[model samples]
Target: MSGCNKKKFPAAKDVVLLHQLDRGIFTPSISPFPLKLETYMRMAGISYENDFKNPMGPKGKTPWMTFNGNDYCDSQLCLELLASKFQKDFSSDLTAEERAIARSFQIMTEEHLYWVLVLWRWVYTKGKTLWDVQMNLPTGLRLVMPLAVRRIKAQASAQGLGRHSKDDVIEMGRKDLRAISDYLGTKPYFTGDKPTEMDCAMFGCLAQLVWSMQGSPYEEQMKGEFANLKEFCERMKEKFWPDWDQCLSPPRLNVS
Candidate 1:
């Protein structure tokens, strides 16, 4: 959309859901899967809540990705593998398969990071952050978009989610790189021999997760823990735009 316009800021998760390939039922907490569903419906051009007890999609694309007329982005493992890829070193740690996942994740991360910068630019030059654009979000999805980061903190405290937080999302993302580095048993890619939708999904999810964890505990801990994720994030940054998060425009929203 015109080199990443903020028009989709309100639809970030929707964008993620639509183009996403597949989904798993009842994967894990309200996270990426719901994002995939929203993205899938949006991509297929459905943007409203279904009032019917059972409402089916337009009978094709969405149906294919759904179970009982519901879309799910089956990417839980992909996301986990992504963290592994980040935490592990690629030079001496990755098998051929892991390398494939790393490469695929880097490509996708680059694409999203470029747009993140664009959104930052637009937040100042054109529109408000989606946070300000509208206070409402759509429903009938898998994950919860979280009213705010405070809610995230509260959720963490309530669940005692063990070393994970709204912040560890990024650390988990950084740790994903370890997949490649730690994989002493496989070849390139987590699934072996090829880059699949899993690889691509991991890319976007991990990148955003790390991006979200900007100043969390895991972030400080990860500064040098996995040089691979940092280097890979940088490499992806350079691959798209050499100067990222530079002094272009002030941030409008704290995405975490």
Candidate 2:
């Protein structure tokens, strides 16, 4: 495609601009595949590196596994989304093995901070306090743990499920976030460094949290919900979403 294709979803060069993992593994996580590659994605903490000097950070994280459960070619979730959207002649479409793998994770319907509770509980079992982006990970790590906790608490209370809610889930998410906010807190971002999966995950959870909190008289009491969380999301927008309007994918080429 030419650089000036009036509706080029992403300029051809920009199409693969900031790839993180395997190119094939990336598209879907960002949604609608092609457009996601045209835009940037948050890739701070969830990545695995050999050292502080990993030259291949841009090569994209090695696929955790292939969709086919054999040699790694791509991620299943990404493969299906691309296949369904593009319907292409190229053979990278999701295979039967890939479809089976995608089915495995269907149990997790939790979105945003709801899943953060899932992750927090998984990690809390290890008693690991100090977090290093390179070493500590569960993919969707917490950026602003306190905000995530607060958001999850808000999530559970959404339907007056407070008493009916699994108190343990609420308490786990709450105490983890509250404790982190209370102890060694508010550093500008997660890990007191750059943003990571934790930041994105926390941002995912709290974007709505802060949006909802705005204009309320309780803003002052919340300390702007702690500046670090707010700023981190802003930084995320700046880096990954320079042109939010460009997020939609273009019409498929109909390669077949």
Tens-digit lDDT string for candidate 2 (1-256): 0121122122232122222222211111221122222221223111111111211221233222111112112223333333443452222344666434323222221232344333333233221221210122233544555665565456445623332435555444444445434421655544444432234434444442333223323234335444455555566556765653343233324411
lDDT of 1 by residue, 1-256 (tens): 0122112212322222223222221111112333333322332334333222122223211211222223432333323333343442223445687567655655544333323322322322232233332222234221443333344345344534322433444434334445433531333433444433343334334333344333333355335554444444343334333333441223335443
Query: Against the unseen true structure, what C-alpha lDDT does each candidate score?
Result: 0.34, 0.33
CA displacement after TM-score superposition, residue 185 of candidate 2 (Å) = 2.7
TM-score of 2: 0.32
Clashing pairs in 2: 20-60, 21-61, 45-196, 141-198, 142-198, 143-198, 143-199
For all predicted structures, in order, the TM-scores are 0.32, 0.32
What's model 2's lDDT at 28?
Answer: 19
